[model samples]
Structure formats: C-alpha cells, structure tokens
Target chain A: MLPMFSGKLCQCLSVTRFPSILFLGVIYVAYVLVGGLIFWKLEGCSCITNKYSLLAITVLKMIKAASLSGLSPDSNDTADGFWKFTSSSVFAATVVTTIGYGNIIPLTTAGQIFCVLFALFGIPLNVVILNRVGKYMLAIERNFSLKMMWWVLTFLYFVVPMLLFKEYEGWSYAEAIYYCFITLSTIGFGDYVADHNPAINYPEWYSCLMAAWIFFGLAWLALLINHSIDLLESVNAYMRRRKNAQTQV
Target chain B: MLPMFSGKLCQCLSVTRFPSILFLGVIYVAYVLVGGLIFWKLEGCSCITNKYSLLAITVLKMIKAASLSGLSPDSNDTADGFWKFTSSSVFAATVVTTIGYGNIIPLTTAGQIFCVLFALFGIPLNVVILNRVGKYMLAIERNFSLKMMWWVLTFLYFVVPMLLFKEYEGWSYAEAIYYCFITLSTIGFGDYVADHNPAINYPEWYSCLMAAWIFFGLAWLALLINHSIDLLESVNAYMRRRKNAQTQV
Candidate 1:
C-alpha cells in the first residue's frame, strides 16, 4: 500500500513538470517581508501620542467645573477642513484613478462643484496618460521574458508595497494585502487608509510616495487587463470558428 | 456693439452646426428633476427619528442615578453585526463591481479571506458578463438612432437612478447627482450611501433595486467607454498617418 501511494505521488509530481506558481508565491511572500523591513527603517519609527489622555483630562475638568446641564458639545466645532496640500493631492489622484477613497471628501458647495468638474476632465486625461504610458511599457515588456514581467509586477509593484503599507500603516498582513488588492482593483473601500491615524505623524513625502505607487501600479494593472481582454477575444473567436465549422459539417 | 455681438454669436453657431451638446445638457437636467420627483413619489416620505434625544435622556439619567465614576460605557457593546442578508448582498455586489464602499467590511479573518478570493474570480466574471451584454447592446444600438440611444441611456439608466437615490437617501439635488456620477464612474467614494440612515426604515426591496441599478448602469457606462476608446484610437491613427505624410513630404 505504501509503495502504491509513493508511486501515485511520483506520478502526480511528474505530470506537473514545473512548480512555477508555488515558486512565485514563495518569492512574493518573501519580497513583502523584506520590503516591509526596509521601509520600516526608512520611514522611521513612531512614538505614542498623549493627546487622547490630555483631552480626556481636560474634558473631565471642564465637566467638574461646570455643574450645569447647559453644556453641550458643538458638533460643528469638530468639523475641520482636511484640504491640506498632501491630502488634496491624494484626493485628486484618487479622483483621476477612480479609486475615490472619499475619506476626505469636499464638503462646501464650491468644493463639490470643483470636484465634479475636475472628475469630468480628469478621468479622460488619466485614461489618455495611462494608455500612452502603457504603450511605452508594452514596448519595454516585449524585450523582457514573460516570467520576468510577472516577477517585476509581483515583487516590486505588488508585494513590496504590501509590506511597506503594513509597516507604515500598522496593519496586519491580511489587512495590508486586503488594502492593496482593494485599491488596485479600483475598489477603494476607504476602511483601512494609510496615514489616517492622527496619532502617528507620517513623513511629508509619504503621501507623494503613495500617489506615485498608485499611478505606476495602475498602469501595470491596465497592461495586464488589456492583455487579458485580448486573450479572451482570441479564444472567443477561435471557439466561434469551431462552432461555425461544426454547424457546416 | 450689440449687432457685432449677435453676428459673432451667429458665426459661432454656424461653425458648430448642431447644438447637440447643449440640447443634450437640457434634456439631462430635466430628466434628473423629473426622475427625482417620480422616485420621491414611489419611495414614500420620511419622518424624523427621536432616537438621539431618547439616547441623550437615558445617558443623562444614567449619569444622575449612578455615581458614574466607577462606570464606563462599553464600546464593544455598541458594535453589532451588520452582515444581514440585504447588507451581505449589497456588500457582495460592491465587491464584484469593484465599488467597495467600505461602509461595512468583513471584520473576521475568515470573511476577509473569502472576500479576497471572491474578488479574484468575481471581477473577471463581471468583465466577461459585461462584454457579452455589451455585444447585444451594440447590436440594438446600431439598429437605433444615436440620439435615441443617448436619450434611453441618459433618461432611463442615469437620470432615473439619480432621483431614486435622492428620494430614498434624502440627499440634496447636487448630492444626488454627485453620488450617481461618482458611482457610474466607478469611483464609488461612498460618502453618501443609500439606506444608510438608521432613523428611516428602508423597504426590503430597496437594496435589491440598487444592486440592479449598479449592474445595468455599469453596462451602459462600459459601452460608452468602449465607444470613446474606439473614437480616440481612430483619431490617433489619423494623426499618425498625417505625421508620416508630413515627414515624407
């Protein structure tokens, strides 16, 4: 029975000549861990913020001093404008890419109007730019092997970013990968956003880095999608031809 | 000055023979308003909820009754499962469509894993379905007038939904339009979600209606995109040919 089982396993192994998928998967995981470590060093470490405790203490003092029921928190006072330079640029990038995390959406009427106008023109402009860049990428891709292209996409564009986000955003592995997948798929679920934690003071360049990553990553994704559509169309045409021949016969 | 201005306007109008863009713009506005009114009638009116005041009263009573220094509100108790049938269906639709509103996400590891796997297969399936349906839409479109196609797509799909969401969600006109545009564009910022107000009781069929709208609306948007891309490519080819001819000359 043992000999027969060993024989069956050997046959299964022989049937699949190369374990390319498994090998790629391992490399992808390793790339994320190592890239995360590198980014952790570069982005610097974070210290705990005492703001919450301070606010709690202040609030308690205020409550104790004013014993009357006339004290109500003004909700309007809590609403702060998030239209800083880095945030605005990130918002703009999200709009053009169709990610639209909407974590910091435009609130005022004029701002909303601007957002619509920007999207009206920006979406097409983004598509044009991506197509032009994709042409150049396609030219470059043709010179490289298919495995090499996959490695580049998997390692640098995808895996590395996953770990980098994990390190910077302090999310678990699953959450990090989830965020990356969601964003790249253009499913910008704004649930787990990078640099959203008020306690952690991220570097000035972080948002820029994230924006650049999204731009290049999306271009690569577009190339992959285009290739996929082409493959599907050719297959479809071949199947139609077969069907037509069968009918004629 | 008036005569010269009128003459200049006449020349501009002549240069652009058909005011198609302007004519379409008026129809689009009218469609949204009429659609909004129709949907408002169908979805029913809303009343204000007293839950907030009730909660405030309870909290105040609690504080007065108990020497609350030893008591703290459990944040965990406030967290309830949002994964009801209707919500789950909406969430699934969002994932497949790559809309990912992130208003309600998978909190468990098992759910998150399932989400990733679902998205992996679902996005491709969605693309394939859209392509097949788009082929039929193309056939129908070719048989009909272009203006007719625009009216159908604009009035039935885009304009109608804008109002429906406004009526149900109680958003302003601008907000409704913004939500529709954001969603159809697939940005899906999710700043304004339908049936999000806990105060108002939404009908069971509301979410199903929304899911259907998104699926069919996306198909129309996809067709529009394909047409635009085809036009752009042809224009690109013409420009390339002109450049080649100029170079040869």
Candidate 2:
C-alpha cells in the first residue's frame, strides 16, 4: 500500500512540475544554450564589438578636433551628406514604421528630441493605416478565386527581392533571406542595411522600392501572424475535444 | 451658369483630391521633409557614417588578419567573450522580442539559419504568453480601487528606471527618456544600448533587470496602444454620429 501511494505521489509530482514557471525557465535556458552554442561555433567566440568600435570613434573624434583646429583639411570626399532627401525619407519611414535601424541615428540633442516626438505620433498613424490596409488584403486573399496563384505571388515577392539584394548589395542568398526575415520581423538590427554603401551610387528608385516593399510587407506579416494564431487556436480546440471524448469513454 | 458649374467642378476636385492617396502622400513627404530639415539643422548636414566606419572596420580586419598570420601578437586584452550565458539569453530574448540590436549578430551561416528558425517559433510563443499576461494586467488595472495610484505607479515605473540608467550608463535625463521611448516603442535603434561598456563592471543582476524591464514594459506598451486606438475609434464614432445628426437637422 505504501509503495502504491509513493508511486502515485511520484506520478503527481512529475506531471505538476513540468508545466509551470520552472519548466518554462528550464526551456528558456536550454533555448539560450543552444543559440549560444551555435553562435559560438559559427561566429567564433567573441565579445561585444563596442570596445573596438568605441576605440575607432574616439580616434575619429580626435581627428575631427584636429581638423577643426586647422591641423588637416577636412576629408569632404570620404564624408557624404547623411540627410539627403531619399535617405531622410528612409530614416523617417524607419521611425514611423518603428523599424529604427540605428544605422543613421540623430546625434544632436534637438534631433533626438524630434525623433521621440516623431515616433510618438508616427507610430500610431502607421499602425492604424496598416491595420486598415491589412484587413483589405486579408479579405482579398480570402476571396481570391485562384488562391494558389496568390500564394505563388507571395513566394515570388520574397524570391525576387532576394535576387535584387544579392545583385546590388553583394549578399549571398542566405544573407538576403536573413535580411528579409529580420526586416519583416521589425527587428531592424541595422547590421545588414541595404543601399548603405555610398560608393555604389544606387539609383534613386532603389531605396524607394525597398521602402515600399517593407511598408507593404509589414501589413502582410501582421496578417500572417493573425492567421497563425487562429490556426493554433483551432488545433488546440481540436485536441481538447479529443481529450474530452477520451475521458467520456 | 458656366461660372457656377466651374465653381462646383473646382469644389469637387478639391474634395476628391484631398481625401485619397495623394493627400496622404503629400503629408508623408512633408513629414519626411520636416524630419530631414530638423536633423540637418541639429546634426550639421552630413552623410552616413558608413564611410568612416567602413575604413575603421577594414583596418580592424587587417589587424585581425595579421594576428592570424602571426605578424603581430593578438590583442586579446581588449576582447571579451560575447556568448556568456547571460548575454546569450539576452540575445535570445532580443530575437524572440523582435528587437534585434545587431550589436552581436551571428556571423556564421548556420547560426543565422538557426536564428531565423528560433525567431519563427519563439516570437509566436512570446506573443501568446504576453497576450495572456497583458489581459491579466489590464483586468487588474480596471478593477483596482486606486486607479490614480496605479497611474502614478506607471509614471514612476518609467521615472525610476530612468534614474538607474542615468547613474549606470551616464546618460542625461533627456537621453534616458529618449531611450525609454525608443525601446518601449520597439524602435530599438540600438544606438544607445545600456550595459554595453565593457569597462564598467556591472552587477550580475544589471542586465537581467533591464531585460525584465523591457519584457514587462512591452506588454504595458501593447495595452497603451490598444487604449489609444479605442479612444481614437470612439472619437471617430462620435464625430460620425454628430455629422449624421447635422444632416438630419
């Protein structure tokens, strides 16, 4: 009797322990471990690039100070104007879109204040507009007679852009795909920004095209997220129903 | 008769043209222009830092290559491990949270692929959990007797953490507020990441505390977004109702 009681107790403990915060914490740690292992293997063991970059920035600052003090001619050739209309639009879009790539952040105090206010207003406007547009797209996608064609178009959307990025930016296919995912996810890491190379002198249409792609793609992404959640909920309900039937039996 | 017909035509053109894509496009362009003008005024008409940074990176690469080829002793003193358990978890959280800082991105092809897959699953999971938690918090907020106190607590939430960041990171109050808005908005420009200074020997809990703050703050942000949208929608509804009543009168 004591052995049976102990066995039941063990079963209860096993079931209860595996579904709560402790279990989630363990899984989270494991996920992080796996990520670390892979990143370490691939990227080589390293630390934050902040130290090296900080060193470089300090040197640059000293050089700037020297130039201002008439030690050397300012290298106008190496420095391009960052606030060109096209690039500024991209920057503004990044703020409104909440993509904040950090590649071209405002350095001055006033600019930073403006950035905050711009975001405060722009983020909601973008969200509301996108929400409206997304619903329209979803309705179209649902009602389209040729659903397969629509899916193919969606597939082509990503594939075609991958080629453009590969050709223009010299990124490999994997990197292009990675960029697409990262951007669409709104992660905007700014690590692999397109059209950032000044020497290439990309066409005016290039950045505009990429910006439009992201603008529309974000709405599509939100739609997909909603659909995915709906799918998961349905599957969950089905599983619950099956369990209920088993219990009844 | 001709003048009145022309006047009606002009009225029709004005009303129709100002309500569609053209109007929105004009507003968007104006917004971008204002942003550009402000940034230029504050930041001193400049181009991207890409050129200088590329030069710096190239030099760093040469240094690394020389070290690898045994021309110079490696400067291991300046480097630290990027894949510490805590940092790895922070990286994982960033991916799942869709706030990719790009400061410590995966350099390997395999690692990048893993990152993509991890995000695919992790984002949805995080969203689901946060959605559930947000609802609970909203319920609590609604039912609490001291709504004013709760609001004050929310105010203090941002204020207290701003102090902590100011002390530890040496950011001014304005810079700290900017970071808070940028991060909570999920713009995550990454230009101002906390705890990035390797020289500062931060407490073990520092990063973890910041991470927790972001995670919780994200849910609160969602709630705020929802509330703002609801408020806008109700105002819209009220405006429409008044318009309809006026027409009837």
Candidate 3:
C-alpha cells in the first residue's frame, strides 16, 4: 500500500511537470511550420536583402516564437460533470499574462463585465502562479545556483543568436536582443514592428519560412523561461524540506 | 534592552506603513476634490439633471469607498531591502501586474533587453510578492472567515459605480463596466473608450477631468490588489509558523 501511494505521488508530480512541457513543445513546432508558411507566401517575390524583407523575416520569427511559448490552464477535476471550457481562472490567467494576442476581447456589456471580473480574479491567480513558480526556482538555486546557470544559458540562447542576427540579418546586437525581448514579453507595442524587405525579391515559400522562424524563436524563449522557473521552484522546495527535517531532529 | 528593541521594531514598522498610507490618502482626497471641481466647471450646466449631479457625487463616494476597502499594498515594509526597488524586480512586478498604464515602455534596444530580463526577473519577483500578499489575506480570512470579502469589495468598488452609471447616465451596464475595467486595467484597448456624455457636451475641460479620473482610479485598483495579497500572505505565513512550532513541541 505504501509503495503504491509513493508511486502515485511520483506519477502525479511527473505528470504535472512534463505534460505541459511536452504540449508546449508540440504546439510550438506546429506554430513555426504554419507561421513560416504564411510569411513565405506573403513576403515571397519581395527583396530578401532589402530592409522590408529583413523586417518581414523578423516579424515572422516573432510570431512563431510567441505561438511556441503559449500557456494553457490546468484542468480541474470536478465531479459536477459539466465541462467549463473557459473557467474564470483560465480566463484570468490568459489576460493578466498579456497573451492578449487579440484572439478574445469583450464585445458586449456582459462580456465586458466578465472581462473586468476575470482580470479581478486574474490578479491573484497570477500571484498564486508566480508563488508556485518561485518555489520551484528556489529549489533549483539550492541544487545549482540559478545565477551561474542563467548566465551560461543566456549566453548560449540569447547572446549568440543576437550576435549572429547582427552579422547576417543586418541588425545591431542591441537591436536584435531588443526585438527578441519585446516579442517574448508579448508587449507587441508595434512601434518598431518588422516590415518586409523591399530590395530582394524572394520566393513565397522563403518568405513564409522566415516568418515561421521569428514566431517559433519567441515561443521557445518563453518556454525556456517557464521551464527554468519550474525547475528552480522544485529544487527550492526539496531543499526546504531537507532543512526542516534536519532542524526537527 | 528587550523592551527597547521591541519599541524600535514597532517604530520601524510604523514608519514603513504609515507614510505611504498617508501619501496615498492625501492623493486620493486631492483627486476626488479636483475631479469633482473639474466636472462641475465643465459639465454642471443648467440643462443637466439633478440626478446627473448626484451621479457625479456618488462617483466620488464610490472612489473613496473603493480606496478604503480594496486590497491595499503594504504602506509598510514587509520585506527586506533586497527585494524592494531592485530595477529588475520592479520592472517584473509592473509588467506581470498589468499596470501597463503606458507610462513607460521599452524605448531603446537596450531598454527592450532590459524589459525581457525584467520579465525573467519578474517571474520570481512575482512569487515573492504573492507569497507576501497571501500571508496577509490568510490573516483576514482567519479573523473574519468571510470568503466573499473580495467579491463584495469588488462589487462595491467596481460593479456598483458601473451599475449606477448605466442607470443614471444612460450607459449600458456592460458598457460602463467595460469602460471601468479597460480603464482600470490600463489595457486601454481604445476600442470603446468613453467620450463626453451629452450632459458634458464633450468639452475640453471635461475630457481632461475624465482622463485624470481614469488614471487615479486605475492606480487605486492596482494598489488595492497589492495590499490584499500582502495581507493574505502575511497571515498565511504566521499560521504556518505557528503550526510548525506546535508540531516541534
């Protein structure tokens, strides 16, 4: 009985950790493929080396990246037998996270009321989510200090790409990183949005390919952050338990 | 020595909490008076109904009510200096909290990178902030056992004025709440923004007055949520410690 209980506990933990990670992975790949295709079609026959083409490629990259890092709400087990597709919790999560993506906005009076209510609910929900994430982060720091790991990983993931983009894509290192951050954060201020390169006429397929790359890149960045947070919290929690046990003895 | 130490601690606590609270209080009062005066100058024409005047009066009243009852942020220092005012921490808190009032956005490439870094920093900062807030909320819940306090407070602060505006000012309840939420959240979708009511004749002064109200009202809501979270977390932590100590014996 004890073995079965422990096994169930381990299974539950693994399930929570891995399912979302895997799901996000699948979604991101799909997003990259689709977004890339669309951008290729849209920007093809345009100047690939021109400023407009460069901008188009950058924008497409952002879209693919964002789609990959998308978040979904945890499903609750309620015996009520009625499926609530849009629970208040989930709605709150989406809006507060700024995943606005413009997919949903309140159109009616009730809808608007619900929107406000959702935000109201979301403010705390965000807090709760962050708390859990924090716990995991502390765990990681205990095992392997996050500062050191973060610096190393950031160098590989962000700094390297930034330099490459500057050299090959004609962006300044600062500009590339800037674009990367803005898109990943989903601010999408649109002030410095990418435009198609006007100089080089590329095929439609190539244009789409560039677009897919941009979106997928952003999505991956978001995913990396989420995963890191989870890992950190898990490590922190384990350390805390160990310390507590030692203290009690 | 013990007495002196306790006294000093109390003093420190008061210094942290009282000043901010007083500052916010003063701001709230000034906002109401200035807002009311502006409305009076701009829209208090002879053609307007007494109800319109009353509605304006109640708007001020609701603002006050909301300020006092809503989740208020710690006017006091509940955490160490390491967590407070760290640029990265502040940026994270500001973004994740959706206080995106547009007072600031990434202006330069460096700034954008900073923004993303902040978002990364923010995920952890959010955890700390939420845990702190949750403790306070738990305390309140224990004392009152009123699970609906937040809901009730939200209704009074948000829903009531919205409903009143709909009935007296000829807005649909949905529209009023939508206006309230969008303005409060600072999402400012700008899709359904409020213009001058017929009574106000869309005057410049009225427009300015409305803008001021929107800004302050949004600040008030944000502060309220921050406060509530802190309160809940403090309470929760205290309880958890107590439980642990009891178990140790």
Candidate 1 at residue B99, lDDT? 74
State candidate 1's DockQ.
Answer: 0.21
Which runs in model 1 stand beyond 4 Å of their true positions? A1-81, A230-249, B1-81, B231-249
For B92-149, candidate 1 gives per-residue lDDT tens digits of 6677677776665665555566667666655665676566556556655555555788
Off by over 4 Å in 2: A1-57, A61-80, A146-150, A234-249, B1-57, B61-80, B145-150, B236-249
Residues A122-199, candidate 3: write the lDDT tens digits: 544444444434444434433454468667546754676577556545677677776555544544332232322334
Q: What is the docking quality class of candidate 2?
A: incorrect
Provide all candidates' interface root-mean-square deviations.
7.7, 8.1, 15.8
Would you list the C-alpha lDDT of every candidate in the order shown? 0.60, 0.61, 0.45
The TM-score obtained by chain A of candidate 3 when compared with the true chain A: 0.34
Q: Give the TM-score of candidate 3.
A: 0.39
Per-residue lDDT tens digits for candidate 1, residues A1-249, read 555545544543442312422343344334334433332332222221112222333454455444544555542222322333444555667776788776756555445555666666556656765665565566555555546877887687768878888778888888888887788778887777776777777889887687667777777777776666666556656765676688699
Worst 10-residue lDDT window for candidate 1 chain A reads A43-52
Residue-level error in angstroms, candidate 1, position A236: 5.0
Model 3 chain B: weakest 10-residue lDDT segment is B75-84
Give the range where candidate 2 chain A is weakest over 10 consecutive residues by summed lDDT.
A42-51
Better of 1 and 2 by DockQ: 1
Off by over 4 Å in 3: A1-96, A99-138, A156-176, A179-249, B1-97, B101-152, B160-171, B182-249
The estimated TM-scores of all candidates read 0.66, 0.69, 0.39
Q: How many clashes in each candidate?
A: 0, 6, 66
